[model samples]
Target: MVGKRQSRREAVSEHKRELILDAARQIFAEEGLDGASLRAIAVRAGYTPAALYFHFESKEAMYAEVLHASLESLGSAVDQAVSRTKTPQQKLKAAALSFFQFYAANPRDLDLGFYLFRGGMKPAGLGHDRDVRLNAALEAALRPIAEAAIALGAPQERANLLMVDCFAHAAGLLLLLHTGRIRMFGASAPDLMEAYVDERIAQLVQE
Candidate 1:
């Protein structure tokens, strides 16, 4: 009974932590990291600033946690989509579409992961480690597709380069769409992504 009570308490703590992270993500997206304060996040999370400190040691820690959570969720979505499909080509296409769909569906999360946090300027300690892990997650998500392209007769180096280019293009397109800088074709970003994936897959398969 004591163990059960402890577990329940831990669960509640985790739930509250998640609430803090989510609130911080929204605040970061809207106001940028430098602009979003611990006090603001506490208000957003319906907690006192002291309560916020209990979950996160500092604003940077909270930001790191938010970025980690976003990457984990995105990585999970890509992994699930990759696992659901059989063929390498299908997996690649599905992964690409899944990535685009994730960003489109969760623009706020994307802004936190890709926009709010400057890549090269990531803090030197835990923040840097979190950034590395996030990059690894992204690379893992793309590995299956890169393997597929190589299996389809493209040179390994070329296939890897192509995969990188495709990711950059898709990410850039999404950013443009989000900022109202460009209107993507079709009703949704995924629809445009599907067509892009189809074309790229065909090119890689032929090469």
Candidate 2:
């Protein structure tokens, strides 16, 4: 009976941790990192501040969790999209489009992932590993696309460089658009990203 009770308690604890994370995501999206406080997050999570600290040591820790979870989800989406395409060019385009679509669907997540650096929320520990793995996965997804483009009569080095450059540019552009720092084609951010990817892919294929 004691063992069963302990297992149930652990499950409850895990559920509360998830609740805190969900609440933190909502609070961070609504208030930004600097503006969101531990007290506010606790209230949002239906817990006392001390209860929140039981799961996360600090506001920074909670923020890190939110960012880590968001990025992991996005990375998985990119991986799935790339795996579905057979050709390198198609893979590249799919990866690009998948990334932009993620941001369009989760602007708050995009803001949390990319723009938080400017807000003084430096990620540490596992957060760093998450970022590195995410970037490497993206690069790996593009490699086949670059190789296929080269095999089809395109210049090898240029195709590889351009593919990396285009992916980086798209990520930066999404960040800028989300932060209201740039406008594109006078359309919604999603439309602008789609148009940009279309133009970029066309230029690459023609070259």
Candidate 3:
């Protein structure tokens, strides 16, 4: 009876944690990071501020959880996209398309996942373990593209360089696109992304 009671308690705890995350995601989407407060999230989750504290020590802790979840989602999309393609060039193009589409569709998630503007800023209470996991998840998302480049005759070092270049190029454009900067030039984000992926694939084929 004690074991069954403990299992039920654990399940309940997990469910509540998920509820908090869902509420946080919505709030963050509506109001970037700074605008979303713990009180707002707690209310949205149908819990008191104290109850939210029991699950997450601070807003930073909760944000870290949300960021990690977003990274995992992007990583999964990349893996699935690559899996659908057989050739190296096709895999690279698919991975790029999957990445662009995911971020384009979920602008908030993209903002949460990419911390380039933050300049090494991490959420408070995000320990070394969380940092390692975040980096691992991000690398996993880009691994297929790098591997594909290697298979297409680029040396390992060259392939790694290519991966970094591709990511920086795409992410820079995406950030501009997200902030409506690209609109100044009368370009569509999806169209720009598709063309960028095509150019990358062509480069891979040539080298």
Candidate 4:
């Protein structure tokens, strides 16, 4: 009975932690990291500021967790898209499209990923260690695209370079989309992305 009660308490604690992280994602999207405060997150999560300390060491910790989850979710979507297609060319296209669609569909997530709404200068990340970890997550999410390129007969260096290009293009398009600038170009981000992917695939494979 004691063990059962302890397990129940742990489950409740975990639920609270998730709530905190959910609130953090939304708030971070709206305010960015420097603009967001522990009090704000705790208030949004319906807890006292002190209550947050029980679950997280600091706001940076929560930001890292939120970003990690966001990147992992993106990686999963890309992986699933890759799996759904048969040929390497198709897989490469699917991976890039999935990356764009993930951010385009969830503008809040894109904001969170880019740390939007900062009023002043912002470092690339919380610090060196956090940046390394976060970049690794970002890299893992984009790795399958390079892997698909390699499958299509591109050398490792070229495939990796192409993957970086895809990331740059996708992220730039997504930024234009969120800022309502894509309409000025008279082309949908998806259409532009498809054209880009089709050209890249053609360059690599004879199909």
Write candidate 2's Cα lDDT for 18-129 as tens digits: 9999999999899877789999999999999999878988877787778767776777888788889887667767777787778767888777865436546574333565
Error of 4 at 19 (Å): 1.6
Candidate 4 regions exceeding 4 Å error are: 116-122
**Where's the lowest-lDDT run of ten residues in candidate 3?**
116-125
Q: Which lDDT tens digits does candidate 1 get at residues 79-180?
A: 898889888788878777787778878887777766433545464434566667767877876676677777777788987886797688778778777887
Among all candidates shown, the one with the greatest lDDT: 4
Q: Write the per-residue lDDT of candidate 3 for residues 1-207, one digit (tens) a residue.
A: 999999999999999999999999888777766678988999999999889987888776787889888988998999999998999888888887788788888888887875434434654335677667777888888888789988888889988887787677778778888899998999887787778778877877786
The TM-score obtained by model 4 is 0.92
Q: After superposition, how far is residue 65 of candidate 2 from its true place, in Å?
A: 1.0
1 versus 3: better TM-score goes to: 3
Candidate 1's C-alpha runs over 4 A off are 1-5, 116-126, 184-192
Worst 10 residues of 2 by lDDT: 118-127
| TM-score of decoy 3 | 0.87
- Pairs that clash in candidate 4: none
| lDDT score, candidate 3, position 145 | 78
